[model samples]
Target: MAAKGQEFFEEQRDQSLVKAHIVSKYFDAWSNVMLGVRKQYGRIDKLAYIDLFCGPGRYTDGSKSTPIMVLEHAIKNPELASLLVTMFNDKDEANISSLREAVGALGGVGSLKHAPQIHCSEVDRDAEEMFAKTNLCPTFSFVDPFGYKGLSSRFIHAMVKDWGCDCVFFFNYGRINAGITNSYVERHMDALFGRERAEKMRGFVRTMNPRQREIYILEELAGALKDLGARFVLPFRFKRGDGHRTSHALIFVTKDFRGYAIMKDIMARESSTEDEGVPSFAYSPAEADTPLLFSLSQPLSALKGDLLKSYAGRTLTMLQIYEDHNVDKPYIAKNYKAALNELEEQGQIVANKPAAKRPMKNGQRTFSDATLVKFPALEK
Candidate 1:
């Protein structure tokens, strides 16, 4: 039973490069995290996956949807095949039926080396209620709702309060921006943000330009997630074909720094085109015909100047640098070391170890927690 106006399992929906890129990254991240977690935990008894808005298992073009992707990844890998459980929910019963058919067409989990437990249910209740009833396991939940109505702050707090649970949700920016001005939607917004913060954001959006408004709203969303105990909240934006206004943002929330690092790397790699040096993605169909413009310079090159300026008069260790600036960004210690070397070559810094005769470049040096670095005085 689909909703009155809702159509289930549409045969024809445009799949753009941007959508492909996003989906590809999602699959890659899922597989990588699954393997990494398995390795880190060393043979856990149960691993779970929950998809709140799981559509039909395949697109019209026979491309796999997220649930299908997860199933395929898990079934194909020997280590991930055992004791795996996947729970899929859809508001539309027809969509759930279609997914079942699709999964059956793939020979189902029975064809795999280890059959996984699969559960499909048509959920008429809110997202929070569905999540509350879910059994606690090491879970990766995908909450990609078409709109922003059902996701509340309290729901998010509950989701990430556990140790091994993580979530990737769709933040429909266009929908939010459109409905936010209305008085009726303000209450819903209050559920998303707190009442006081929602009122403040409403007043603030009134004076901002479109770009500023988007940035502010996203920042607020990120802040809300952080307050809810998510250690890392990374957003990947998607835009309409026109290349101006953003359609939605995919927000990944996790409690582990390692998962955060993996997602950042996946996004940076997926978004970028051919050149590893140039990282850029065109979110719009209008720019699909055009080559990917290298809008920003290489991150390492840019970070060198910032590093030199920050450490002009101070001595710091690699751990200190990593802690200070490398937490949220796509950069790691290796990138930081590259930046340090660039500064050292330009006479802006010195890599010093006890009784070392000469300053060493990052490649020639091995940095430990006790390694010391000195930034020379700026030229007068």
Candidate 2:
């Protein structure tokens, strides 16, 4: 599975794919912390970087793995090397070897003063132990699991229950939903959604067939992150068709609001500057002129749909959408359309329309209906 993403990474290194967004997002967050360290901390308090499913460098077109690039950049700060540590882990032995070689090629051991540890092990096992052993230090972990799914509620709980830990997990909604909305999750749901979510999700999509799995998985995931007490989360997706696609949740969960602020800051910094005639958030509208969607092996339309409705529940206008989320607008629009269509298809909305104010310049509000809203307010 890890190899597959690597392959995809190599294939889409220069194109608009998941790898680009993934790397950019990480660097944004890492650099933000670096700024904080310089301005406030004045000295990083043992700054630490952890990649749960960190793969090796050079995916397809020599594009760098996020963790490795982040490590390289972080240590470049004079204070970072002396105070920070990098722990990059993967379950694949080959990937681990590649990571080691990558670090070595760049000059290992002596190259980095923080003594970054690159290990080969399941992140769940290693993350827990590492957390228990380390003292309070700013941490950033990338839980990029395979397309099916990755990590668990316990994983989020253990790392985040403490206020200092901040994690960004890749929720492969399409792949997981194909199974989750079905009977595949019957056994280990508790592991995935934290009991409460598992049970609620099971009930929500019980009558749904395999096709509805994506929605169920996405809802369950957002619910799980909420369970872990996340302030806010925005998804990242890669679409293949109008309704069929692959999507993942780049969920940010943290106990502190600063973390939420930090995520928002990072997303805005990393999204496309190009005008794709759509909003720039990961889920921006088509007119936003932004495109960052990528592909994986997951079928996540339903999950993406659920998340879009989640957005409609709170957001009102393009400005509000931009303020509340940091993902590109095209991505937001994708999620928005999925959820809106789902809501409408289910007869949840009878007269849903955009709430328009008087346009002094142009009274084209008659056809100005690209804004999102849910009639009858489905799924409060």
Candidate 3:
């Protein structure tokens, strides 16, 4: 199975539009974090990029992999041109050779400003051990495994325990669903969720259908990540081309709200572009075949209602609203502005700020802590 997986990847290196989209989103998120860190810290002494399942440099179609993408971004962006350390690990020596060749073709690390250190190792190292040897510099690690063998809650806990370290990992939902009933896979399940939780989950979802089972497992994984100290966990679902079932989920775990907000924005933008108005966070392949009245405005309207209902007859500053709702599930500060605008249009809320007669959108009006927002009086 492993050999076939590698062969398939090599053969279709340039194929899989789904993978292309996923990788593009990954690159976007990674770039955002790098730039954000630089902007936040002024000048980071060192930044680390680690890819556990680093593939060959280019796909068959000549597209760059994650490592190449990282290097290109660092070279292009002045802020990220500072001291950088990148480690690419893969079990296959051929993949390491290909990645080295690809880096060399791109002019190698010497082409960068700081002469970034690049490490390509063909070893079986897990996240826990890799993180143990890592320096105190801020690190972003990408964990994309073929299955859930080496990934454990304990390892994830250790990775995020350090300040300024975040992770993006691929969770194979299909594989888990398929192997849920197999006794031989029990050990892996135990390692993934911890033995006690795994047994409890197995018993809980034993009678669920495949879809239900997958959802339960995903929820459990997200919960485990939270328990392990990830302040923000966002799961981006990827579906097969047919849009019948999910193939896998890209889970982003971070310790900072800014990182969470950045990823949320990226996922929303990418999914909306691909799904045509349906945000990736709210998309389901099973419902893809059936059409419903879903539009870009629907989310805004819903947000407006939710905010009004939650804070009726109360006043809050724009910052307060964002702080309360930005980190909430299915909604971010980006969604709050539109909802607030819509509420003002309907007289459901009033914005009390200088020259704020009209609803604010984007740069038209800036939200501040002193800006008062009063919801309409609740009926007696």
lDDT of 1 by residue, 1-380 (tens): 65533321221143233444455465556656666867787755666777777877676567677777777766676566665677787776677787887777664467454443345543333657756666566777777667866677667656666667777777888888876677878877887777877888888899999999988998888887888778788877765545576777777788887677666666655552323243333244444445455333566766777777777778989778866876556565566765665566676676775324535554354456556789766678
Candidate 1 vs candidate 2, lDDT winner: 1
Best by lDDT: 3
Ranking by TM-score: 3, 1, 2
Q: Per-residue alpha-carbon lDDT of model 2 for 323-357, expressed as tens digits?
A: 35433223433333444444445665422353234
lDDT of 3 by residue, 1-380 (tens): 55967754643342234344555565556656666767787766667777777888887677678778788877765556665667778877788788888888775456465543445543233547766665556777777878877777666655666767778787787787766557899987777777887888877887887678767888888787787677788887766534456777878888888777777776675452322233646334333444353234556566677788888888998778877776636665545665665567577787886435544555555555556899876687
Supply the TM-score for candidate 2.
0.63
- 2 or 3: which has the higher lDDT? 3
The C-alpha TM-scores of every prediction are: 0.79, 0.63, 0.81
Clashing pairs in 1: none
**Each candidate's lDDT (Cα)?**
0.66, 0.56, 0.67
Query: Model 2 off-target regions past 4 Å?
Result: 1-17, 20-24, 27-31, 34-44, 107-111, 124-136, 147-150, 181-185, 206-216, 241-243, 265-380
How well does candidate 1 score on lDDT at residue 245? 68
When 1 and 2 are scored with TM-score, the better candidate is: 1
